[model samples]
Target chain A: MMKPGTRLKSAVCDAEIMIIKIAESADLSCGGQLMAEAPERTEGDGDRMHGCLIGKRYVNAEETIEVLCVKSGDGSLYYEGQELMTKDTKKLPSSD
Target chain B: MNIALLLQMAAEACPDRCALTHEGRHYTFSELFAAAQRAAHHFLAAEVKFVALMDVSSPAVPIALMGAAMSGVPYAPINYRLSEAQLTPLLDRISPAYLITGSEIVAEDRSGWVVRSSEEFMSVVSEGEISDLAWHDDPSAVAVQLFTSGTTGEPKAALLRHEHLVSYILGSVEFMGADEAEAALVSVPPYHIAGISAVMSNIYACRHIVQLPNFDPQVWLTLCAEQSVTSAFVVPTMLSRIIETLQQGAMATEALSSIKSIAYGGGKMPVPVIEHALALLPQVNFTNAYGLTETSSTITLLDPDDHRAALEQSDGPIRARLGSVGRPLPAVEIEIRDEHGAVLPPLEAGEIYVRGPQVSGEYEGRSVLDEAGWFPTRDAGYVDDEGYLFLSGRADDVIVRGGENISPGEIEDLLHQHSAISDVAAVGVPSEEWGETIALAVVTAAGQSITEDGLREHIRNHLRSSRVPELIQFVNELPYNETGKLLRREVRAWFAAEAA
Candidate 1:
C-alpha cells in the first residue's frame, strides 16, 4: 500500500507531482497449504487429516492504490511525485 | 435589381461605421464600399460574368460577395474543405466565367479568368476612377449559389436570390435582437450556410465581425474572451468541445462570460450537455437554431427558457423531444404532411414542408419543388401540442429493420452515455433474415478498453433487444465528409470490409 507522503504518477497523462496520501489497500490470496506439527510422512493419511481435508485452499485478494497528486495546467497531461515522459511525447520520433 | 445598391446606400448612410475586421485590421462601411466599387470596375474591364470565391473568412469574403452583387454577377463560395474530386464536379456544373482566389488556394489550371488576391483585384480598380453604374434590383436575380453536402446524393447548387438572402438576414436580426452594438466571432466554415448567414447578419447590423480561419477550441475560447464577442453561431460539435475545454479548466470563465448568446445547430444537442452549459455559464443564453441550406439558415429557434421548461415538465421523455428544432420563426410556415401530400395533425410524424420568403423554390438546374410553392424539407419531424417542432433525423437516414423503423440518432444518443464510448454511429447493415440489421460503429474514449460484447450489453440495458445493434465495430474515429457530418454509408462499408 502507498503510504502518506508517497508520490504516484498518472499513468494516462504522465503528470508528475507529490501524492498527499494513500487511500486504501486490499488483502490478496495466493494458495493454501495444510499445517502440521512436523513433516508429513505420507502424502495421504486418513488420521493425519486436520479436519475432513478435501483440498488445499488459497486466499486471493484484489488491491487498489490511490494517491493524491498536484494538477498540471495541461488537461491532457497529469503527473505525480516525479514527471515521466508522456505517451504523446514518446509517440514522436526521437531526434537522437 | 442589384443588392449591391442597398449595401452602397447603407455605406453612404454610415461611411465611418466599422463594417468588417480581420486580424486587427478594420474596414469602415465606406472603405468596404469603395473597395467593392474598385473590384466592380475591374470585373467590368475583364467583362467577367459569374465568379467563384475560394478563401478563408476575412474582409476579402464580404468584399468579393458584395462586389459580385454590385457587378450584377452571381458569386458562389466553395468550401475549401472539399476534396479535389468533389470540387471538380461542382466546377464542371457551374463553369463559372471567372474565378477569384487567394494566394493560399491557387488553382493549377489558370486557363479561366483568375484574380490571385483581393489586393490584385483592388490594384486593377485603383488604376482608374470609380465608375457610376446602375444597380440591378430584380429580386429574381441569383445572388449566391451554395452546394448541398451531398449526403443523399451528388451536391446540388441551391440558387438563392437577393430577396431571399436579404429577407433571411432581416428576419434573423429581428428575432435574435442583433444590432450594431453586437460583435460576432464566427468559427464555422465560411462555405456553409451558418457561416454565410452569420457574416451577412452582422453586416446588415453594421457590427464588427471577428473571423476564425478554422474552429480550434483554444483559439475560439481565446478570441471570445479577447474580442469580447457578444453573439456567435456554432454547431453542436463545437459547443461540445468548448464545454469540454471549460470543464477541464483550459479556458477562463471570465472571458467566456462576455458572450451573451450562442446559437447552435447542425445536429441535436444532448440535453445533458445543454444543462452542463447552463450550469457552467449562467450569464450566457443558449439558442437551438434549426434550418438547412435550402432555408438559407435558421427557420426556427428554441430559446433557453423553452428548453428549461421542457426539461422541467417531463422527465427523459421531454429530453427526447429536446431533439426538436423548436418553433418556426416569424413569417415562416411549417406543415407536417403524409405520403399523399396531405397535412397531418399536430404530434404526428411526417414529411416537414416549409414555406417562407427565405426558402428556395427550386434548384439551379432541376425542379425539386412541388406545384404548390412549398418546398418539401425531406426531413421527418412533427410539431408538438405547444407548436414546438421535433426533427427525427433525415427521412433517408431512417433504418427499417423487420418492418420496424428506427432513427440512428436515437441509438447514437444512447451509446454516448456509456462511459467507455466517446462517439458512435448507427447504420443498417444488410441481413439475409431481417432484411436489414442494426450495426454500430463506435469510437471508444482514450485509454478505455471496451469489447463488442461489453458494448452490446451496455446498449441492451438501455434499449430493447431488437433495438440493440447486431454488430459493433470499434473505430478510432468515425468517417465524416468535409462538413463534419457522419458518412453512415462509408462507416457501414468499412465495418463490413473489416468483418470480411
Candidate 2:
C-alpha cells in the first residue's frame, strides 16, 4: 500500500509519481500495472497505452488518492481500478 | 523527510532549468543536485557532525545546504562579518563541523573540524562522481540552525527541524509552479532566515536565482534587467536604497520593468518609502512579508493586490491597510493576547502569538512552545476588524510612561510622516516622577532644520499630549542592524548616557 510522501514509479513505464494521499485498502496502479519503489525496475510497453504529462497532478474519482507527475510519460495513473484525471492547479499567494 | 527532497523533486521535474547563478556562473538543477549528492558522500567520509558555511553568497551556499540535508546534519551559515572573538562561541556551539569558507574569514582550525576554502570545497565536490548516497528521511533531524541577529541581546541559534522547513515549503509554495523563464534575485545574506527561505521557495517553484553577495542599488537594478528577473526578496533597507537610487534618476527608466514582484521585510517599512515605491513602480507587485527566524520566514504577507488597492483606492479602510502586514498565511494561525494570556479583541493592541507546523520555537536544546503549541512572537500589535495585522514593534520596546504603555512604532510611524523628519526613533528614559518618560531622536530631511519644540509640536498635533516625547534630540541617522532591525537598545543606552 502506498502512502502520502511516498515516491513511486510504474513498473511498466517511465512515469514518476509522488503520492499525496491514499486509502486504507487501495491498490494504486499506473498503465494497468501495480506501483513499485522508484529504485526497482520492470519493463513493459505501458507508455503506449496511456500518457502522463509533466507537472500535472492526477487524482482518483473518490479523491482518496492523489499523485503528481514529476516526469512526463506515456502511462496513465490509476487507483482502485479507476483512471485519475488531471487536477487544476490552485494559485497560492506568493510568500517570498 | 529531509529538506533536500525539495531540490531533488525540482531536479527531477526540470533537470535543464537553471537553478542558481553566482558571479556569472550558472548551475542547472540536475548539476546542482549531482554536486550535492557527491558532497554528501564527502561529508560522510570526513565524519563531520555539522555542515557550516562561513562565506558570502555563492554556488557553495545551495550545495552546502543540500549536502547537509543529505548527510542528516544541520546546515549552519555563520555570519562572516563577526570578529574572531565573536565567532569563537558560535563555532564552538556547532563542533566537529565541516566548515566551508571564502577568502579571508577562516576560523582557527581545531580537532574534529575540517575547513576548506570556497574554491577548494567547490572543486573537491565537483570532481567526484555521483554517489549512491542514501539520504536520511528522518523528519526530526535538525535541518537548519540560523542565529538571530541579536541587536538587543546575545545571538541565539534558532533550530528548524526537517519537518518544520519542509512543511513550510509544501504549505506555502506550489510545486513546479513557476514558468520556465522566471528568475528570482536574492540579495539578503545567507545567514538570515529570509535568505534561506528564498532559496528553497525559488527552487521548489522551479525558478532560477541570482545571488548578490553584497547589496548595491545600481548592481541590483542592473542584475534584474540583465537576468530578466521576475521576482525578488529584499529587506526594508535595501528597498529604501533602491527607491532612493531610482528617485535620483540614476537607474534607467526601463531597468526595473522586468521585475514583476518584490517582497520586503526584516524591519518596519516606513509608509512614505512604500508610497514612493508604489508610485515609481506601478506595474511591479509589492509584497510586505512579516516573519521571524523561528517561523520559517513568512507568516503574514501584505500582498501586491493589497498594495495596489491601498494606493489607488481612497476608502479609509483600504488605505489604512497599507500599514498592516496583511493577513496570516493559510498554514498559520495568529492571535493577539494580553499580559494575562487572554485573547484580545480586534483593534486591541497586545502581543502577537502564532501557531503552525512551520513555527519552530526550538532554540538549541530548549523548546519555548506553550502548552497549546503557540509561540509568543514578543511583538506588540493589533488585528484590525478585517483580520489585518498591524505590528507596533518588539514587545520589549514598549514604553511605560505615567502608567500608560505606548508603542514606539506608532510614535515613530507618525514622526516619519513629518516632511522635515527623514528618520526617527522613540525610546523611554527613566523619569524621577513617572515610571518612564518618552524621548525622541530625530533625523531631519536633507538641508532641513527643526527645533526640539518644533518636532514636539508636530507630534503633539497628531497624537495625544501624553504620547508626545518629553525630550527630543536631533541626530544625523538612527542605527540599524544589517537586516534593517532598529537597535532600540542602543538608542536607550545613548539616552541614559546623555542624562548622566
Top lDDT model? 2
Error of 1 at B478 (Å): 1.5
Backbone clash count, each prediction separately: 17, 1
Model 1, residue B11: displacement in angstroms? 1.9
The residue ranges of model 1 lying beyond 4 angstroms of the native Cα positions read A1-96, B103-112, B122-128, B175-181, B311-321, B447-451
Which whole-number lDDT from 0 to 100 does residue B378 have in model 1? 82
Local accuracy of candidate 2 as per-residue lDDT tens digits, A8-80:
7777777877665555544767777777675355555444357887656788777777676766766677777
Model 2 residue runs over 4 Å out of place are A1-5, A18-27, A38-89, B103-107
lDDT of 2 at B228: 90
Of candidate 2 chain B, the 10-residue stretch with the lowest lDDT total is: B101-110
